[model samples]
Target: MEGYKKIIKKLLFFNEPKKMERFVLKETSSKENRTEDSAENNAEKDKQYRARRRKEPGGIRKIDRGTDESSKKEKEIQKEDENKRKDSEVSVYLSHNLTSMKRLYNIPMNGDVVIREFDIILKDRAVGAFIIFFDGMTDRKVINNNILQPLMMLSSLEIKKAEEDIAEYIKKQILPHNQMKEFTSYRKIMDEVNFGGCAIFVDGIAKAFTGDVKGWEHRGVERPNTELVIRGPQEGFTETIRTNTALIRKRLKDEDLICQNFEIGERSNTPCSMMYIKDIANESLVEEVAKRLKSLKVDYLSDSGELEQFIEDSSFLPAPQIIATERPDRVATALTEGRVAVIMHGSPFVLIMPITAEDMVKSPEDNYVRFPYGNLFRLIRYFGIALSLLLPGLYIAITNYHQEMIPTDLLFSIEAAREMVPFPSVIEILIMEIAFELIREAGIRIPGPIGPTLGIIGALILGQAAVAANIVSPVLIIIVAVTGIGSFAAPNFSLAFSFRILRFAFIIIGAMAGFLGITTGLFIYGMWLVSAKSFGVPFLVPFGPKTANAFTDSILRAPIWKQERRPDYLNPKDDRRQAPISRGWMDNGSKGEDEDEQ
Candidate 1:
């Protein structure tokens, strides 16, 4: 230790051109440690100590001035004093050398030892102190009040002796009986304690004791705003990550369920939790998800949507690569099917990774309803989505480009309707489409009751007035209204938006080349749909690949018991979700009473 100290001292300050002078001073016997008994014997120790000074005092010396000794000796003493002061500052409880206290709790009065300082106070009639160590990561209240007050107000004088006394006092006087464990390590206390934990430091002890002090504002669980359901669990995930995880866990109680957490964002330190189930989930899938999450280097993430875009597999595709669901049961079901779920702090929605095109069409309510009814609704929704996308384009094409395909009576009616209007069919259709879109947009912006009413009134009044004034045909109004209704039938709003944009492209093609243009537009649209993928799975799975089981619930309705296996799109380990012979039907078990009597 002595040799190491000498080396440190020499390396820090004593190295210089005058090696001979430094050696003469340090090697000399004047600077050796002295015994306490010998120090008492020499009454004029200070004067004797200064007699060997190198730079002799010229005149009367001031109290602060050092006696003319070797400059190295004076500097060495000054350095030692400064170091001693720094050590004192760092040690929190100098007088109390408590054995239980960890090294981290030490708050030195000395500059080098003191890690941080915090003000102590009382709150809700409990003694506490605020720990201000981490700049932004830790909550301030836990440090100041939870930790400091308990240590300061302890009745015992000897801190080492008061270990039990302090712990007991905190349980009895300061904290609730259940909170005793909170007055331990600062790390565990802060994390486990319901309230933010506080830490207090004594002078000599290197460790601080933390107590629970976490209580803050939070929102109550409510129905999901975006992913609304007509028939399903009403509860939605809150901003709290713990609450969100609990919501999922409540629905899924399997032992294999795993939730790994990480703190990202350099300054925000936002917590992100990844949820998956073992055995059922693919190991590679979980590893890939964790790797991607670890790779994220952002300052802050406000929502899961922001993270989704950053970590998604494909950026150019309009379809969402991740399935963001607000429903907890949905997340649990996904986990059961061996899919990974990513949940972000301060966001209600949980993101299901490696989603397929099939995910956009599926709903949480699908499992809730009977198979046949559910399948019917699914088919209807698919039809509605198609109508929403192609209705206007098809109408334009049939009326303007492929008039021969139209029925004779329908064509005459359409021509009669158009005769009253001066604008060309394309211009007339475009005008009505734009106006309807504006009305629909306006209705969404205003308050609910008024917004819908205004939209309805505007559409009806404008369409009627336009027809009366010969501005637009009544047939065009009908086409636009049906198109709007079809768009609303889509399950996913993001997918619906993609289809809406695609509608315009079809409309332009139809006007340019008539039947040839419409045929080419359909072909190109089909190709685009086939090419799109969500995650690694094909977006147009059941339709493009033509899998037998994939179409069990696709395009047409299938009976519930017959649809036993899970969709193959997800590559589930347990494909058969239902047992064979689940359908209940028994016919020949008993004889009739009359027949038996005879």
Candidate 2:
């Protein structure tokens, strides 16, 4: 050990201090000489690089190469600051406004951006002005008749007030458009133009007028294709954000309903509306939702689905933390329950957040049906959820490890069916699952009525073929078919997807350790769910934390009159949604007293 230490010191140059010092000094001297030569070469290279940059359109010159990078960064920062300040507000000079607008919008190069120059012939004098908007986005008839014709030809009298701004005069008197909004900031004007609205900038005025002439073609409100109901309002949400908001407003006529607009995605600048009841929704919950949206730094959010992913609590968890639905009625119902609704432009699906697991299992048809009928449907859905999540794993465990659990005749039948199968139970189940998924995907990819027809025919033919070929046993095919049907019964699409993924995990676990492994997975999943939160509200709400109204409203639904209070887990400002005597027609003496006692 002593000899080894000594040898290590020698190799590491620790023992011979003088010799090591001398060698280090020699190396340092050589490095200094090499650095001096490299410095000269670097300076020459910098000069050549600067010369090349100077030839480019608008490059700044630096006096010293040593401060080149720092100077460049400082200049960039100053230039950006100046531009922002200059373009922050509208300018009086029409030429300057024209130049800024052109540069900001990449005019002439942008095929759709139209700059229609016109003169608003006032009685005093003609004022130079221009309107900018995307060609396909703006309605030509509205622009030509409501705006251009009135502004150019209908100015019979001049403004008597000398102090009144021209932009204000034009907004109040000249234009016949209803949705004209005056903006002092160029950023606001630009945003209006991007959203299919047009901006009117006039000379001798330091303000701009924006009109909402958004006329881009969109789908009409139709029966919800994905979530069809037999006994409810058939109108689903459309891609246009304004239309979706209108549908909600038509249902909810309360003055306290507030809809605040937010812009997400730095480059995309997609418009989003966050809505909640002013008196019912908790202030902190509203702030949390806004904070999450404002903090998202993504460049593009294409749909509400994408926005859901950004604001959800946990990304890796199979269960979705937010609910996305295509029906406008559902959005209205959620808002009434003190939930926040996030509606994004260009997507039919609207997102409702801070929801419990029980919310996902509910159907829109529940309210229209009788209380007993609704309760029956809820039970059926819960049973379907159980089958979708655990049926395959249970089947695998029973046949492979818990044979005694099965009856004698059924067990013998299962055995006879699997006699010709080459793969084990696990592999056999996986093959059918994958094949079913492929069929479902292929059906979706094919468009029109053909999609559903193909799905139905394909499933039947595929299952029959697999059974006949002995690739899978008849009993396994029945299990897979039942599982697929149960997954379809899930009310929310996201919840269905989560169950589909967990089904596979459960299958693998049960295959390895039979029923015990399956039980362990469920235990861990339940624990995780108990701890998970949606914007600070417990995910498993009444079940996990044992909150109020768990049984009355969650697992089952009481009569409409019996549900007098909102879900207390939300901590809404006004938890009492209705008075004890909700059924005004019924005599309140006995029923109201009973409710009060509870």
Candidate 3:
């Protein structure tokens, strides 16, 4: 062994340390010398190469080389040219000549852009004028009767002063349209014209007058198809934002309910209205909402849903931070609660923000019904939420890991139902759940009257066939049916969808680790809820943080008189909704007694 060790040490150079060190030092010194010589040779070669290049005819020296400088100057010139092109692309101011206006509108190229040029006969002489409007957008009757008839036929006869300014005289005495504005920017004129309005441009004037002649077809206010209620007002919001705001105004007559209009979407130019009670809502909350809305850089926001997605606090969260409803009463209620409602044009749904879990779970009918029944239904909804989210998971856990916990008779029946089924409980549940979801989606996409019927028939036939074919067990069918019912019971559509997504997650976890996995999932879900914020308000507000006053109205509908304060979580400016003793007349009963005695 010692001889073998000595041989290994010799091979590894561990024996004779001084000799090894000497060898390494000599090699390093030689390498350094070689490197120095190579560097010197490279320097001399570079100097010679430069000298040769300089001696060649028409050869440029290093300092005189202009390739990089020329390229940089070329880039700068291109950048400046691009900036100039962009500036030139900006819309020009309204011109004095009718031909210029026609060219600006691209009259010959765009068939929809109509430029009706006519002679404006004044007392002194006839002046050239034109009206530009988009076809099918503007009301032709208003243009002809209000603008044209007054300017062409009436102005010539009415104007007596021969020296009066033609544009000013026509605007003051001729145009009778209530909504008219004088604008100098052609961009503003185009926007107005695009929005179903007409712009009147004069022959020698640099300014144009625009009138609101929007009379395009829109669906009228109808009963809400999604959020149906029996006791509350049946009127729902229409696609037209003006009509929707009017519906809210009719319900909420309070002058303090302020509706601020904003035009978003560079391409779509979709109108949005932010409604809040000025004196009651928190100023910061209002400002924050407005700031976020203004910060959006999207070009086309088609609906409130799209707007909500753009401005919502978090995109990854399954739960919707805003509540969208077509019911005007719902918007009115939200406004009274110190929450902001965003009403978008072309969408019937209005988005209510800074929403909590309780808000999503509570139906609009909760306020209309008696408090006792409302509270009862609210409790039932809570149960439904739990059932929808956790029931499938619990079933999988119990059958797989806790079968002994089941009662004997029920266990026997469950076993008998599963006898012919070939798949496991989790697989069976997943099959039924996926099948039901497909049916639901098909029902929504399928046209008219047949939708609901098809959903029912599809579910019934599918469930029956699955059981008979021993694909999914009968007990799994019952579980899936109950889960579907529970999902439908959620008041908010977005909240329902979130629960649907979490339901699958719970099922997978439960199948892996049984009840332990389910408990862990619930804990993580609760933690996520506690941490999530909706527009600076906690998602689990008044519950995790424990607001005493707000707790009474959450998950339980208190009497209308008892709910005398808005949600404290909102930090409302005006907290008190009503007097402490709203029924003071009952206490002061002498007036009725005196009348009876008399």
Candidate 4:
């Protein structure tokens, strides 16, 4: 071993022969020391690592506790904020102090809020009274002539005798306004003030009087932008809910026509009017609509569109269950047919409920036009609906899977047009369809008189450019144009939108399995429609459940005299719309002659 050590030392250190023995001895000692030191260092490191691992869980626990505390503090702050808001909404009570009433209005801070203070003389006593209104919301002329003029100047002479109750005397004989109400809640009074009305507060009275002086600038009852008919009522619903309800009421003039008022939205407090002929409409249907509207807990309801989305039966379905129309005549007609109309404040569109697929397709003109012409137009619309939904999918299916379905010359032509195109038929169609949709959306959003013109020009230019560039085949352009025209032919805009969405879906399905995929998709769509319900009425009504006297009105428009009964599907209280012998004057005098002969 010593000899081997000497050889290693000579090779590694290259020491002199005399010191080789000493070097070997020193190297052996150093190796033993290194082994001992390495063992000790490793043991120390293991001990330190174990100590850190043991403390890690505790540190994590402390962090979690800190997070929990922070979350708790945040929740507490939110709770306090909510409580403060509720406290601020405390009810208003009439105090003998006029300064307190002014404070209640948050005067000096709110610039638009106006408070006019005056004295009312009753014999020898003068009582302090004030009126509060928003600047732009209320009509200053009406408030001056009707409310303030009588209370401030005319009341002194009118109440020559001593008045024990000032509130009753002013309310009964002083205020000449037609629409005035006494309200006790501060929340309610503020709401009235916000919505174009003035509130009168008396120093000695516990209640405040609210008058309807809503004369803010608004659009007049104009012709409907959508749902235009050739021979029907020209007037449409305005943004004002009262005016809309009045429009419907004017048409019906029935005592049983009920228009119940509801306030929806937490912040908005938008007025919603539910109208129905009490004797004709089903009770359950009306109650269902009310229940849905009441149960909504939203902070703001901007329009009928939002309300419809929230209360609709199914959000996943593409088809709109509620029929939204701006026409007051349509609302009246639906009310007569045992349907409920929900008119939202600040939106011209009125929602007609318990609608069927057939109802969406029918235009108001169908009723006004002669039966033969109406039936012809209705049939054409049906064809348009089919073309819009199925045409593109059929094109994709036939070109991809069943080319034999097309005529020989047409197939050759399609092949020639597509030869220059780089993409497949499916891709080409998708490109064109997407381009068309973009054009449609741009047309709607573009401002001014150029909007409609831009849409037409844009579509024409895009179609021509696409074909010229060979990005899309010429045949596809014609197919897309026809599909777009068909979409326009749909009577209801919502229904048209539904068809547009389904067109894309069918296109995708057709590309996958051709004819088989289209068939499957159609079956599923039909099943969904049949299963869906709009306010308890089946979406595919008069067809799925098969109601009598309803089928004639669905696809075909029967003569007005023959359609003597209301739709059986609605379960209207009154089934007969007219007498069986409605056209008795035109009939032969068989019964009258027999009676005369006897």
Quote each prediction's TM-score: 0.67, 0.86, 0.83, 0.84
Compose the digit string of candidate 3's lDDT tens values, residues 361-406: 9899998999998989888898988999999999999999999999
| Deviation from native of the Cα of residue 35 in model 3, angstroms | 40
Error of 3 at 446 (Å): 0.9
What shift in Å separates residue 109 of candidate 3 from its native position after superposition?
2.3
Q: Model 1 over residues 493-565: C-alpha lDDT tens digits? A: 7778777777787778878877688789778766876887655567677777766565666555467677677
Cα lDDT tens digits, model 2, 352-406, are 9898888889898988899999999999999999998999999999988999999
Q: Taking the tens digit of each residue's C-alpha lDDT, what string does model 4 give over 409-493?
A: 9899989999999999899999999999998899889898788998899988988898899899989999999999999989999
Candidate 1 local accuracy as lDDT?
A: 0.67
Residue 503, model 3: Cα distance from true site in angstroms: 0.8
C-alpha lDDT score of every prediction, in listed order: 0.67, 0.86, 0.82, 0.84
| Clashing residue pairs in candidate 4 (N, C-alpha, C atoms within 3 angstroms) | none
At residue 139, give the lDDT of candidate 4. Answer: 86
How displaced is residue 423 in candidate 1, in Å? Answer: 2.8
Candidate 2 matches the true fold with a TM-score of 0.86
Deviation from native of the Cα of residue 426 in model 1, angstroms = 2.4
After TM-score superposition, what is the CA distance of residue 501 in candidate 4 from its true location, in Å?
Answer: 0.9
